[model samples]
Target: MNFSVGPPGLIIAAPRSGAGKTTVTLGLLRALRRQGGAVQPFKCGPDYIDPAFHEIAAGRPSFNLDSWAMGEELIATLATEASAGATISIAEGVMGLFDGAAARGRSGTGATADLAALLGWPVVLVLDVAGQTETAAAVALGCARYRDDVDIAGVILNRVASQRHFSLVAPAFDRINMRIFGAILREDRLALPERHLGLVQAGEIPAIDQRLDALADIIAAAIDLDAIGQSARPAKAAIAIREAHSDGARSRLQPPGQRIALAQDRAFSFMYPHVLRQWRHAGAEIVPFSPLADDPPDATADAVWLPGGYPELHAGALASAHSFREGLQKLARRSIPIHGECGGHMVLGRGLEDADGNRHEMTGLLGLETSFAKRRLHLGYRRARLRIACALGAKGTEVLGHEFHYASTVSTSDDPLVDCWDAAGAEVPEQGARQGSTTGTFFHVIDRIAI
Candidate 1:
């Protein structure tokens, strides 16, 4: 058997969170696709939402490359596997180029810079030139000089007011010896809709294709597509990926069972693509059902997984889904392994309070009650050691994951699932709840502890 080399790639990053990284990434993906290029898209951290939009623009599934939660070998293997046969790959950065968790992982800090340095890819910073022109070049120069290992190859000016604004910004970069990739004039029409978590799900947008096409047209006309394509370098890991197969470097999460029942649809759509891909590669079969559609878990399945999504938004509909609730209860009674993450954990509880303070009955599999009426943000990277054996892993197993939600726990009487610690290595309270063979947690698992 022969292995193929992965595609050349680059990272699209920014100086801060709201600096048009997503806009530039989506537009670039669509623009490259429109130019008849096979583009593979990727996200830098543990983001579920942006990858959905990436898939739409790139016409392929986008995978998360979390340096903190995942080991270097896993990241390299996944990246190489996902980029096979594509002409180029584009990874959208997280908060900022250098922003990351306080603690480092197996590699460097989980920053976009770590990924760029690891993959030998160049970073194209997207600068929001709203209020300043030459000052933008200063920011780029500082980022380029801040780290020796990571390369800041070029800069893209977003929100340029006019030709005068572009003229001022372009020459500043030339003076600093920084490459100017393109200048995007201010366009309110290109902004994607947003909700609490982030942008509204791509499927929710009725004119998603039309919007993406518009973005492609704008980006194609403004940016230098050929130059951007030429700048990409083949992934350094791609050359050594074949060795990963012989070294026992593979997915840390074991298949829950031979046949798995998965909750899907808009309400439960936060499942990771790589997790499912690993399970399938390990010979596990996934059968999907919709709780919002009153569909029950497949009875033939030996395990059931309910991933995170906007369950709070559809509390009333979920409460009224008698068949779905009954099926879950039946599965639990039969001793089948069942696990829930974030929103799914909320639905597995005794009750849920919606944003309007209305209460709705849930499956009552656990003694947990959650309320969105009194929202409190819980966001961070987590390191967890299992306190009780469940679908995720056996007792004493450690896992790396993250939590990002606005729901608070009202009450819980079940045994704790994991002894958890935040990214700073500070021990937090015991998290999640477990009863019988059922387990649930707000933490979304990315990978297990590297052995």
Candidate 2:
């Protein structure tokens, strides 16, 4: 559908992290939504946390506009399409505006500034004016002038110490020919809750709206909401895509099963939004049960899928779910297809040992045991070649995915999960070992091919 609203204004960020970009972005989204403006939210990189807050603010699933992963044209197209009904679109910056993937090179991940220039959207710079006053203006001036292609829309001073600080820094924006969007007081509650997997996946937090409301109220009261809304400029052109992957053309149908129960709760929430959307589009009915609540797979389900999440945190609850255990055991006895991802892999194992060396009984579908205490950071991009047939794909099939975990398997079979290839084409060991109808791993599949 063609969007009717004009192009939205995007936020151009700093050259570093911890600059309060996320807070300012979230505040604006909530404030706009409260003001009755149709606002669509977009993030500039591959982040799961911020998008959760964005979805809360916009009341719709917000998509990522990654310059590196998805390309600039696609980013522009997503912005244009998303902006169709909203009065203004807000694309939050990543680490920093001018910071690219590398220190200096063409191969570095696309930076926030690169995306701003590509979309022809004006940037409202959010500067942390903590210790210095006029120097803050110099930083804003430098970011604005560093690249002529990017237009500096306005300046929003964050973490201002006092009224004197605002008075000291407000003129710096005028001298540099930049508009002052608004200033925000330092607030602690506005800080979003976070865990290892990123801002505590939205599904994990039930009171997310309360947090968004607090942020919106603060931003609406302190910042000039109307002027900031006006600061958004029409994107010169829609986000475009030059090269498109052929995953949509090659459809992989999810095999039919009477009852497909998905493990969903705080412990199993790291699912790709598109995957579920596509599954429903492909005529698959999904039933959800909670491991955190000690609920097992419904007896009617013929297949069970456990996505990744913080299984280590709820070790006690998961270990004690009697109904969940008995229900899963019943499914296993019936030869059901059971698949697990990072956290799911741990739960299906023989046992889970917490950081304090406490072991908890799990589903024991596979002869694997995971430990968070004996952990090592495993972060990387992966390409996999499946050796056996499963519910999601066929044998000898290829899939692209990523791995982000800090858990190790204490007792596992020698057989590997699937053959993995790194970005450099070097082969790593198998991601996880599989036996029978159950499959699992530490890797999070990107699903280049539709599943």
Candidate 3:
């Protein structure tokens, strides 16, 4: 369906992870922007890192559009809002094109296909033609035939060894009438840096622009930018216009307060892009403070939001951030709502033990002890039912969120935060802890329930 909200858009997806989706997506985004087009970037799942690189490539803020954790209505609202004021919107898919949460939706539940069908965006599948040449076409053909809701418009061959390699791979697609865009040569430099979570955050890498530009050069030389732009189209279904209901007044997640003191630095900077955007849309004022730089939250602000980042890496510095600790302590004393997620939750504990087993003093707002030394991966979509009403919602209210952390709880208070369930609704142990007005949890809320 054609959308009047913006110009044509497309999804860069693949059969699987490590199939060069990120590289191709970034390259195409950079290549598109290099031509002086306004590009709006998006990631299909609950990832914060990829959107960072997407922003650097597109020269604008990239938002997350999750189908599993978030309701379909919320995802469409986010996509519609993100595409505003742009020539084109490009969403990089999570995992394989068909891989998504287990649900009964338009496209195999929460798969990238679901997101594509939801947004009415055609997909350009990226195939990694590493060793096999002709077999790549079979894979692309399977993806095309497997799903009816999604449109597999074209294919881009990545990691081709030579011209001969392209020749062997191109004919199979040609024979099948598949549009083959371009074959990217095998290059090690195209691989982006990685860490424990995913691709290194854009800010962590030095000269990311130069790196993206170099990638763009490689992609532009190989791919057909004009053809891609022509094939890109808006959502097939018309988007429903949503009116802002007074900065979070009718928010899914209860607004912390009218004035929120948000922690915004390298250490605590994983706030959901859409959450803050919608909060502002609701008319709430955000006051940012740098806890990593030893800055304090504004005293006048009523709520303090500590987002998750790499606080364990800077445990010593945070332990010594006099103003940050003192200011938050002051707020805690005033019974103001202080919410912490993931690493921020670690910082709100009595002590944080880094990877080396060295303990560092924390805000002591929550009577819990956590450590990175005993790291255990807890990663998945979460559905939480509030046991008690705080800032999130009234008691028994539900919210959709995701948890991705490697910190282990050493100790916790008797009072728990919320009861959680996996994506499929299996009950999880009551996770997180609450003390006074302070609430700490590893779950980073993506969206509250549609109701």
| lDDT scores of the candidates, listed in order | 0.89, 0.73, 0.84
Which of the two candidates, 1 or 2, achieves a greater lDDT against the reference? 1
- Report the error of model 1 at residue 312, Å: 0.7
Give the residue spans of candidate 2 off by over 4 A: 1-9, 67-86, 98-121, 145-152, 193-210, 233-259, 298-302, 329-335, 388-392, 395-398, 421-430, 449-451
Local lDDT at 307 for model 2: 88
Name the top lDDT candidate.
1
lDDT of 3 by residue, 1-451 (tens): 2233455789999999999999999999999998999999989888889888898899899988887766655666667766788888899998988886665422235578888877778999999889997899999999998968788989999999999878888989988899988889999889888888887788989899999999999999999999988888876555544444522224355577899999988888788888898778667999999998889899998889999999988899999999999999898899999989888888888999999999999999888888889879988778888899776767887787888988888888748879998877788764777888999888898777634
Worst 10 residues of 1 by lDDT: 242-251
RMSD of 3: 2.4
Point out the higher-scoring one by lDDT: 2 or 3. 3
Clashes of each: 0, 15, 7
In candidate 3, how many Å is residue 342 off? 0.8
Off by over 4 Å in 1: 1-5, 242-251
Which pairs of residues collide in model 1? none
Residue 193 in candidate 1 has what lDDT?
A: 91
Clashing pairs for predicted structure model 3, backbone only = 1-235, 1-236, 100-111, 246-282, 247-282, 247-283, 248-282
RMSD values for the candidates in order, in angstroms, are 1.6, 4.2, 2.4
Q: Where does candidate 3 stray beyond 4 Å?
A: 1-4, 104-108, 242-251
